[model samples]
Target: MPVDAPRPSAWRLLLIFSRIGLTSFGGGLSGWLLREFVQDRNWLSEEEFLNGLALSQALPGVNVKNMAIWIGFKLAGPAGAIAGFMGIIVPPAFIIVLMAVAFSKLTDYPLTSIALAGAAAAAIGLSASMAITAARRVPRRAFPLLCLAATFLAVGIFHWPLLWVVLGAGALSVAVEYRRLSSGEGI
Candidate 1:
């Protein structure tokens, strides 16, 4: 569902991610990215952004960073990926270092702590919105729905190790899809 977004130069990509990195705090960076790239800019479809979100979650390292690279690569290429990666990572890295120094004193303040808690709560709401948006797009099929529920149970409820859950569930899901495809069921 990728539409023709005016191709942003690498510098422009960096500027965009830099804006996100500079402003976003207390988490929910992916939500900001989703709004920026998908809903606001139409740089990518919700489906593509959701797919990258899945990969970013599955792979090791930072989810937002991975998503930045994924979006950048999809939009431009390797250079664009680098632009996205550095744009998100470098700016935030510096700001976090600076904030850490300042935050030591801030942490002792009750109001500061309260404000941070409120921000965290808001971030969770943002994350929930993103999850719901992605969930709405899942195909209406028994196996896929089952896989979604099982994965949720394993990770969210049972607190299973993500590696095992992903490997086992992914294999099962792939097998099911393969069977459907082979049987001319059109996965």
Candidate 2:
């Protein structure tokens, strides 16, 4: 979508975030956000959403909270950020507390572990979908492709610390891209 695409009202933003928060389980909330905002509503373009997702992941807090605030602010300004924060945090907080209480009692059952495993599988699928989408947007060039593969190998195969892999790969990618752009090669 364009920068001037219609924005949602704060209330609408709140409701959307709240629904995701309440229903979302396991991880991969980012994937769900990408689907809802980018695919379903066209409230944000894939690039815009991906940028925010990157920023959110790099930031110091919970990725979901950061994403909620980022999307909320993008769509509805400060009030939207507040609504997003509250909607994502509050309802889920209550549900988590309730689940915690219930799960404490149910932990003895094999079914509980099976149910958790199912949720984890679903989360992994969502995450993989988002990863494929992001990977598809990577420029089909050698440096970008190398960085992608190297990062995958370093983190996924070698079990390098994620922070170090990201910092190294991200810095190298930026430097190469900057040099290319400066030399008019990319242009």
Candidate 3:
């Protein structure tokens, strides 16, 4: 498929993306976000969703939020973007604020700390699940594997600065893409 722009209804987009934001627990919402909008719903093709993901990660407050905004803008222009952004943010923000207020009073109890510890563990599991999902999606190529290894070494082992790691990985990715393009291979 050519992967042209999508034209889903405004309300539908708002409702679907909003549901994603509300239901997504733990920290790996981005992968779920991708699956919902891209694979399950077919609102966006893989390439378009991947492009949006890249852009979202590149310039973002949050990856999922940025993705909603981008997809909203693409679908229905500025109004769609606003609807998507507000839909995703408002529900979560309201719930989080309420939880924070409740937790502030509850923090004195030992059970609250235990519950939080459980939540943290669940969050880690969710993050790992997301990583596995994303790894499955990554193209099986030497350069991408090399980049992944370097990233792991830089951030995981060396604990290098995040900016440097990102920059280095980005440069390597660009070089790999350029080489692939020159070789008449699919991107």
Candidate 4:
């Protein structure tokens, strides 16, 4: 059976994406964003979400912000994109500014430093969790494995400049993808 196309609704799109922005915490909001719009609501298909993710990563901006713009445009055109961008940025910016003020006032205290150290540790743990989750979802193939190994070598072992590491990884990924395509594998 053919699926019906979704009709755009600006207010609904604003409300939903805003709520997502407000609630996302401890990182990995990308997966949660996918779950909210693609799986739970069926506003986007899995393929669409994946494509948006790829595009967002390629763009020169925060991944989540790029994603919000792309998804918003997909849902309700340019107006939706603006709304989504504002909804995602404003509240967090306001909260962060307030937190920065508080942190500045408390910077000299040893207890504050200790508390920040603990928060940093928790952030690292969260980052590792996100990495493991993403790794589990990656296809287990020789090309991907090679790319991963090369990335580790470039950044972890050799301590190459970040730009070089990114460029090398990106080139390797493209080469692998090209080889896969030539071998008649689906992308």
Candidate 5:
């Protein structure tokens, strides 16, 4: 968001997050959030959203929930963070319980299976789109590209444990960047 942009109220943030939580499906809530806050509303700049996204992904909880709080804090402070957390979590949690009960009885239907398959396909597409977006933001440098390739091969091709790959790759990336910055070649 621009420096001159008006800040949204906590109530508005809560309402938007609640709506997103209630309506979003097929996963990729992070992608939906990027579109909603950055592209559609211009409430946050792309860089801000992406930075929060990276942090959220690195953290231990659900990415979308972490993003909600991050965004809320950026836009509206602590109260907004509370609103965002509640908005993104509480409503959907209740709905999920209800949906689980309903879906349990519908599991025998072929249509149910088909619908689930379709949802899964959509989810994969959304996740792929998000991944591509993030990848595009990576600096087109040898070290970064090599790290990206190594991480991809480790996690995607070799099926190495994700935690270890992330830890190792992240540390290497940080050390390299730190060295580069220390040498005054930082981009």
Candidate 6:
């Protein structure tokens, strides 16, 4: 978006997101994105990248997909957004279908289950690591921390419906932040 910064072509954007999408196994895709779009390419700043990350997470769908859209839109508007969405989804979609078919055929084998379990554990680790990295950027204030914990407890422990929890918690959090801002408290 910068005048001086050379923008990547839409094709290039697709390729970049596609590569990240396909190769980012287990998890840590967001980390890969941050490194590629922010650190390596210098297309976006750290704050901008993190803000997109937060927005993507707060939204209901897959965080990585949301982030792909956000980054694409930021870089090249609507068409870029389409490219980003397709890049992240299309190639992997095919691969996943193929894998599912293959896995179904292999389901009866003990080694298949063991391999999948190991993969699942590694995926969890990657996700947890990403969460911790993202959490470090969250405000260290009591209110924010309480909100985080409440959301986690509701969704993770209580198994509350995510829609209601997100709406209620998001509204409350927004109201609280608004009040703080109105009171001249720095966010």
List, residue by residue over 1-187, the lDDT tens digit for candidate 6. Answer: 3568898877888999999888765567887788789879999987788889889988978989999999999998887898899999998888899989898888889999798788778767767866776777776899888988999999999999989998999999999999999999994
**Candidate 1 residue-wise lDDT, 82-166, digit = tens:** 9999999899899999999999968877999888888899899888888788878877888888898999999999999988999
lDDT score of residue 88 within candidate 4? 77
lDDT of 1: 0.88
lDDT of 4 by residue, 40-148 (tens): 8788877677778778888888988898889889888998898778777777777778889998999888999897677667657655664565565677888778877
Off by over 4 Å in 4: 102-137
Task: Point out the higher-scoring one by TM-score: 3 or 5.
Answer: 5
For model 2, how does the per-residue alpha-carbon lDDT over 1-187 read when each residue is reduced to its tens digit? Answer: 5667777999998999999999876567889999999999988989999999988988899999999999999889999999899989999999899999999999999999998888899999989998899988867898777887899899999999999999888888779889999999968
Note the residue pairs that clash in candidate 2: none
* lDDT score at residue 82, model 6, on the 0-100 scale: 87
lDDT of each: 0.88, 0.90, 0.79, 0.76, 0.90, 0.86
- Model 5 spans > 4 angstroms off: 156-159
Expressed as tens digits, the lDDT of each residue in 1-187 for candidate 3 is: 2366457777877887778778766676766766777768677777777778779889848877898899888777887788789878888888889888998899789999898788778768777776776666777888788888989999999999989899889987988799889999983
In candidate 3 the C-alpha lDDT for residue 141 amounts to 82
Clashing pairs in 5: 1-45
Candidate 6, superposed: residue stretches over 4 Å from native: 1-5, 25-27, 152-161
List TM-scores for all candidates, in order: 0.88, 0.86, 0.79, 0.74, 0.91, 0.82
> Which tens-of-lDDT digit does each residue in 133-173 have in candidate 5?
88888778899889989999999999999999999999998
Residue 108 in model 4: lDDT:
89
Q: Model 6's lDDT to the true fold?
A: 0.86
